[model samples]
Target: MQLFAYLESFPILHIFELLELTLAIMIKRLLFEEAEITAREFKIVAITGPRQSGKTTLCKHVFKNKHYVSFEDLDILEEADSSPRSFINKYKDGAVFDEIQRVPGLFNYLQTHVDKVGKNNQYVISGSNNFLLQQNISQSLAGRAAYIELLPLSLLELQEHWGNTKNPVFFMMNGFYPSIIAKQSSAERWLPNYLKTYIERDVRMIRNIENLNLFSKFVKLAAARSGQILNVNNLANETGVDNKTISAWISVLESSYIVYRLQPYYNSFNKRVIKSPKLYFYDVGLLCNILGLNSERAIKQSNMYGAIFENLVISEIKKNRFNKSQYGEMYFLRDSTGNEVDLVLEKDGNLIPVEIKSSAKYRSSDLKNLKWFQRLYRIKGGMLINQSTENQELEDGIMNIGWAEVANV
Candidate 1:
């Protein structure tokens, strides 16, 4: 039951060596380029993502000259709430407003200041709750604000230490959170506390759920269903809650960036194609903890290993896509008769199919759905992602790429 003790059994990562390798992450993020461009062009640039994904750090790094004020401080939040105009005037030169969603009414004041000044890069805002942040932005600063989504570290972002050779399972268990990867922090020690805080603070802020214990149960149950088609009715039954409550809780999780729903790609490919979206956690290490897979051996022996592996590959690819400012372009293909491709990426006028498998042994049969889908669509190239270290080209245009190289694809 002791999560930290169980995690300590994994292969030790030398702290000194890891610090040397992870220096690149501390120095730069893939989103820095996009954030910089947005800040230059837009009067207000908003960086939003799950908490501790490094929004504050990235904002400070990108806008070093700007004064930073956190609204998480109760006194500061009260001041902004009571005297929005004066608060805005106090930071008239410009400031990074961290956790801006806490003072929703302050956005109108921000709008006024930015308009009168008529200068770009005058204000930068960030928050963890996407729904509240975007709602405030749409109501007040729609055209003036440009948004950037920052997920956990992508595989490509951490390529210096973990790109080609490390086992995908290791990263899956350790996770890709900035502190965990950049500081060699213990996932076991950190994630439990993070989850508790999210349930206590974010869930309360988003919506009033009378029972925190029930909500916690719903989240763990949801984690168990990761990488599978979401069946709300069944989940509601299992959680002893109505479908409507289950649906609302899911929205809270999605808005807070705890989990994401990967929609099913539908086309003329089949009329009976499954339309429900599949669920996935934004960070695999958190998913592992929720499922009580504290040790590496437990992770490998558990039946969910394959699903966890699939989640890692898909989430990394998503981070890569979002880092480039692309949104709503990823999906999975599954039909009534057991035809499924792990991931389907919609590119510029083309559908790039990707298959994920956890086994290292190359099985010709594992490529069945990928091959079938490509031929049916008359697509020329595809990728078979697996646990292999050596990237190789197979018959046709499909390539077997290691999981660590997922973000690159």
Candidate 2:
């Protein structure tokens, strides 16, 4: 059965009926659409993302007929690590290899097999550690495999699954990890363990960190500074580490797909644009956990509420574009004169400035940065994504878009 259908077969109580239905609908992810399109052309396909983001589930659901093996099983991993050729021979027809990064040596053998067969859609590989998986891919599987990144679920996908009743604060607090949503688990209970596993497994595998506690502190500090321009020196001082170590740790976070940096937009017209990139987590629920905000009410009242909301909208835009198999050319705009826009999406020579506001109340002044960007760049239009329920066309090719309808924008 499909993942969602399998979940639906459980006997749900009357009180839990609505949530169960929502989970059932969410089983149909946007990445499946991208996977189907990619499978037709590539001899091997790889899906990379953070753990529990549903990489394995996606490959299994989309390639139901393919034999499946997971490297997490130590016996299988040992065999593949010891003798990759024999392992590949065992799955000649094709197979989905979960956590393929565990056995990087297998890539070379798989490459040889696929080249010999000259077959399309011969293998599906999934890994949570992008640094290792991508490095191995470049060294061995380049030009032989297609790649897709599957992040936590998108707001649009959640809306399609649950309808319009979900509060924005709820999404901000809970985030979009599929397991948390599908099983109706509390983020507080789940995210701490998730962080522990990430630090203990992926972090150690990526780099040698003698002090795991210090690394955990750095992660929390990074979360505290989410949505702000990255300052490695400051982070280093706070964590009592050298600047280079701080940089390397941040790279670990990024390569593991735990955090992303939004590069600042630069144009000849504005020489004073900020050059530093802003930091953001892939899932707000994880951010909330790092911040110790357990409930929706807590999230709404927290000091970082606006920043977290902005993070969610920015992440949604990225996820939406990625799901459609489009490269995301997203940036943030800020100048020394204090003009700033939350997100600047550049595509095909057209610039779309998006302003994010946490309040439901919309005012003309809320779009000041967007208007300033349009004027400076001579861009025809911009978007204001806020909590307003109605969409409105404001002055000067600017539109006030409700947060729920951001996918349409």
Candidate 3:
């Protein structure tokens, strides 16, 4: 087939080719909320997230009328590197450069160019990995840019796309990747593809690991230990990977927004406290898949039930804090002496302690650690989250609510 004939054969494909950014997603309303914040006063809006999380699509949608280009294309990357000023001149004005970190030096050029040559919304840059992109942009576009992160689509965002559902089981199994939800496919099919592609793309782009097969196994091992107090040495010993490699790989995961670490609260107390951070998979569905739990039935019968509950409670609360106008912080209470609470929430100078139980039957025993935390923090009230019938405030004055209300908790 001739070149023009091949192009003519698929006219529709060329007619409207999307850049695979935010607009290709159904969570536009949620992303719009994020865009509104960035568009406020900052000269540069750098939207960063893991690969395949829709950074490019959203930016194009927001900057549809502006000059749009992607550094993912090698030619443009070379053009920006060889002649940045010419690249700027080429794009008349207000330009959106997708995956701009492909050429870090270009940010230095934009810092001055956007000011002298263009208007408020003149330039937008996107990057997949912050490990390399952070230092580049900081040295160049530090104060001039307004930055926001785009993690895997949130539950509320997914709710906007799929409407509402009563399936906590669905989230635990499928996780909330945008492509998986927007297209609305079965968890069994998409989760495997998601893992294979995500590992192949992100792991190679950020670092040069000699053994990718080992690194892949490491991801699965890390998933099994989600929502637990992580001991780096222990993990390294189990995976047969050195402690340094484990630490570096975990940092890669953080920059990619695949997992998060919550630090323990430190206070002035005689009882020694464990200062180590706890680990959590940002997407519970991905975590479950990594653990090899196939379905809702598998999850319900697993020994990881307590840990899953912990992940649910912590993630839901963290999501709530981020979604609101005010920012709220999450903490866990644990001491060297061995007294611990499953989750701790700190906001507006107050400490709220919560304990999670796997059972539906209620008892004061469930609130033991919360009661202990209350004495130290003067907590407004303690909470015991359980899987049960109704939400109640116990006679001891602690709020005990069913864990099923995690969405509202």
Candidate 4:
């Protein structure tokens, strides 16, 4: 297949390219280490989320005491692929298997080992591609696996290491992918190369993309459409590919952690549930690059301000979800009608509904959906997050908070 067709050619490399895999990953230490404790409690820790979202880094970071073996290391994968049990036995007491999806059969063997040992965090298993990884894990590990989402650096984690800045707008404009935060000499070349390399490696790894050009076009089109309700047919028409391929390509981007789909949330007494999902890029800077967004001035003047704000909102929710140290447990809410809240935090079935707005000025109308949905679902309460200067209690029973405040809390 001509799947490699989509990888744009570039003749340069950044210094960070050589250093990314072993740069001492400052954010790893700053990230929620206490969060990994939950996975340790489970029989097998299944770390997932988008590519370069740092799944491998987190595994390496947490399993400092455990021997490390990467399937991408060729020899290790050959061992696991040829002799799953023996491959595992070599690790003996235990080890970290990075990108275990490359050797799916080993999971069952690992599960057996954990069962025999009777639990105590026997294995630290992580995969960048979740769609197939989850399927194999469910088939092999199931209840034995504890899955955690390792997304791109969260705003809160960034602030911790990078230090807090006065510019909320700047952060919102660039967003949080670790490489961008590294302050490399040339994010210009770095960003595009990163996207291209990711497209070639992770995107092609999932499915054989015969029409790489179409796939590349799909990325550009998707970037331009960020923050809008995703229309598969429209995307299909634009890309000259079937909706199935478009959908699959989008899934590839999502699985690679390049973009995320924000499923809408709401229930006007079962009146306004939207079926179509809204898509957002994992990082604003990447989206901006694909869409040709060059300057902070340009992002500010662009019409996507509201959508970018909403993207920031969801990204923060994802960060905190991981921040809590819980594994594989974050989702949005919506029904059949159009009444919608931006995000939903569903834990233990409590249904914490959240809303996000870009304007510092928040109004009662902003939280109407949340209030209505909360009353109907009997949720804990509706949380209204925005660019407000300070966290305050609104008279109308809503919690008005700055985006940053809500992210850490």
CA lDDT of every candidate:
0.87, 0.86, 0.74, 0.72
Local error of candidate 2 at 341, Å?
A: 0.8
Better of 3 and 4 by TM-score: 3
Order the candidates by lDDT, highest first. 1, 2, 3, 4
Worst 10 residues of 3 by lDDT: 14-23
Candidate 2 residue-wise lDDT at 400: 88
- Model 3 alpha-carbon drift over 4 Å, by segment: 1-28, 117-119, 159-163, 395-397
Candidate 1 lDDT (Cα, 0 to 1): 0.87
lDDT of 3 by residue, 1-409 (tens): 6855755765563423442343364366355566756765677787777766666667767777777788877888898899987887787466777877678777766777777754566677788877667777778877777776666666555555667544566678877666566554577787777778767877787787778789888898898888878899988998898999899999988877778899888877634878889999877877888888878899999999779867866776666555453466788888877789888877677777888887888876787788788777665586788777689888557888876565565
Per-residue lDDT of 1-409 in model 4, one digit per residue for the tens? 3533422242234233434544436655344365367655787777787666666666666677888788888877787899987877888787787888988777778878888889577787878888878889888888887777777777776666667644556765455666666655344565777778877777777888877777889999998788778999999998898988888888888877788887655445655566678788877767777777667787788798777777767766676766666444444565555566777776665666677888888887887788777677765566788888788877446688887786564
Worst 10 residues of 4 by lDDT: 6-15
The positional error of residue 335 in candidate 1, measured at the CA in angstroms, is 0.9
Cα RMSD to the true fold for all candidates? 6.1, 4.1, 4.2, 7.0
Question: After best superposition, candidate 3 residue 246: deviation in angstroms?
Answer: 1.4
Which segments of candidate 2 are over 4 A away from where they belong?
Answer: 1-26
Q: Please report how far candidate 2 places residue 98 from its true position, in Å.
A: 0.8
Judging by lDDT, tell me the better candidate of 2 and 4.
2
